[model samples]
Target: MSEKNRDGKRTARERLAVEREKQKSAEKRRRTLIVGAGVVCVLGLAAVIGVLAANAGKDKKGSEEAGPVVAPSGAQGKDSLAIPVGKDGAKSTLTVWEDFRCPACQAFEAAYRPTLHELADAGKLRVEYHLVRLIDGNLGGSGSLRAANAAACAQDAGKFREYHDVLYANQPEESDDAFGSDDRLIELAGKVQGLDTPAFRKCVKDGTHNSWVNKSHQAFEAGHFGGTPTVLFGGKNIYQDQSMTPAKLKEMVEAANRG
Candidate 1:
């Protein structure tokens, strides 16, 4: 072969080798970029999953802090929120929504206690008392909640009626937060025989029925009543009537019993 022809062929082979090297370098760069992109995508997904897990944990913790709604023993009606005070066979049902720290509730209880007792004892009427925290919400104190919880504790001890009377009889002023003290509540429990036991004290101190009282208050708000001392008879709001009295209540109950 001529020397010039050999040189030209060798140069052509060298050029081909350089071109192949350039292609290999480009491919390596492309593969590196693809791998880096994949890593970025994986890290982004991990961050998203971490945020979701954290939010889920917060939700679970909030639910735990809210605790459970435990209804009292022998509580009737929806969610077992009503504390029944008479025989189940009574002809008429009187629904009373009351807050222990409410002066109006105390007045209503004072006015109707005897008649209510008479009707309940005679099996002519059944009183379903629903305790609420209206005063606590309005007055910005925990007295209503504490007292309602104590009342539920009393119900657990089978001394709800007597203790309920004692609470109303000794209720503080409208703005007073006297009932907020667990000691005072436990002290008052002494008025009722067999009600000041260790179990009762523990129930009161632990606020065992605080959640239940909160649920009852929620039910009251859902009911959309005007305020505390909401007394209902035969599906009518008798407490709203200006002329309503214990005599009138007794007469209505007797009439219902007759029917």
Candidate 2:
């Protein structure tokens, strides 16, 4: 009876050990899964933040107040460039020359895009966007030439609107962070859909076709532009005088149509 008792005790001990080992293995697996999940969540959040920052850094700034708060136009010009806004009353084609890094350019976009949209929708204004990069400096800096080139690269991949809208929307706070570095620009480039990222990088880094941007910059500065959103109608320069409200812009456009 004593020997039988001893054997029973040994068997019970072995079973207990097995159970404990099984529990230990399960705990290890749970910890591993938890760690993996945390990593994924962090990565996703980082991506979201990057996108939002890029968008905000690209829009709105101040400009000159001279002729009309907004540029004016006549009946839609013949075979000129247009982004097409509104189809009401008279139609006029207007050209916009913009520098990506300019604060005034940013301000102009915010003030004008809605009216332009309304007019295009109403067959009133056909606005042609001529994106002019005026940023200059190294990859890690911001300038007119740099901005123009980067934007041009973005355009090649058929992401002109996305890139344009994003940059204009994100116009950086007027400060050291605005003319963002090459890495910053590349990061900004990543947010747009269908933009070929690697190719865009190669183009901006190598300064390929940089001359194209230089010429535009020279032309703008020489043209006596003191601010962005320089408006031209049928080859005539539209002047700016005060801070433009939507109402003011419409007034100018209507008056130009009459003249």
Candidate 3:
């Protein structure tokens, strides 16, 4: 072969080899980038999963720490959520759902308490008081729950009616969370004769029926009632009637008793 031709051929082969090496390097770089991206995606997903798992663990721990639901003594109705205040054989049933911190509830109690007492005492009507924490959810305080728990403690002492009346009579302003204090609740217990014993004080302070009160509130929510002081007579929501009054309630109870 001629020297020039040989030189040209050698140069061509060298250029070909260089081009092949460039292609291989580019392929390797592409593969590396793809593998790196996949690793990053996997790590990001794992981080999110870890955070979610940690949050779920925290929620489960909190639920476990809440303890069990303990109903008060002599609690009646479904799930023992109702505190009964009269003879069981009464002709009519009056279900009252009330919140201690609700101004409307206090007003209702002030208006109808006399008739309720008279009817209950005469064994003409049985009152099932289901206490709730509506004000706590609305106004951001624990007074309603605390007061309900205190009332449950009174039920244990067989003085629920007296203490319940005292609670309404001495209810704080709608914005005041005075009932949240265990000392205040115990102090009120003094108003009800034979209701301020050590056991009652302990029950009030320790929130013995807190879980029960929460359950009752849940029941109230499930009922889909409008608000606190939801009074039901013979399965009818009498409190919603604009014409409902203490005298009207008394007449209804008498009519039901006659039937």
Clashing pairs in 1: none
lDDT top scorer? 3
**lDDT (Cα atoms) of all candidates against the true structure:** 0.79, 0.54, 0.80
Residue-by-residue lDDT tens digits, candidate 2, 1-259: 6999999999999999999999999999665542343333233233423443454444322111012211112212332212223343555777777766655566567656778767666665667654444332111134444555566666555565567767778766433445445666677777886664678788666554345554444455566643355677657655353444567667767676667
lDDT of 3 by residue, 1-259 (tens): 9999999999999999999999999999765542343333233223433444443443221111264789999998899999998899999999999888776677678778899999999999999999987666555457888999999999999999999989989998767889988999999999988999999999987888888887887788788776667789878888667778899999999999999
**Judged by lDDT relative to the true structure, which candidate is superior, 2 or 3?**
3
User: Roughly what TM-score does model 1 have, to 2 decimal places?
Assistant: 0.74
- How far off is residue 182 in model 3, in Å? 0.2
Which ten-residue region of model 1 has the weakest summed lDDT?
Answer: 56-65
Ranking by lDDT: 3, 1, 2
| Residue 256 of model 1, lDDT score | 83
- In the range 1-259, model 1's lDDT, one tens digit per residue, is 9999999999999999999999999999765542343333233323433444443443221111265787888999999999999999999999999888776677678778999999999989999999987655444457788899899999998999999999988988757888988999999999999999999999988888888887887788688776667789877888767687899989988988898
Candidate that beats the other on lDDT, 1 or 3, i.e. the better one: 3
Better of 2 and 3 by TM-score: 3
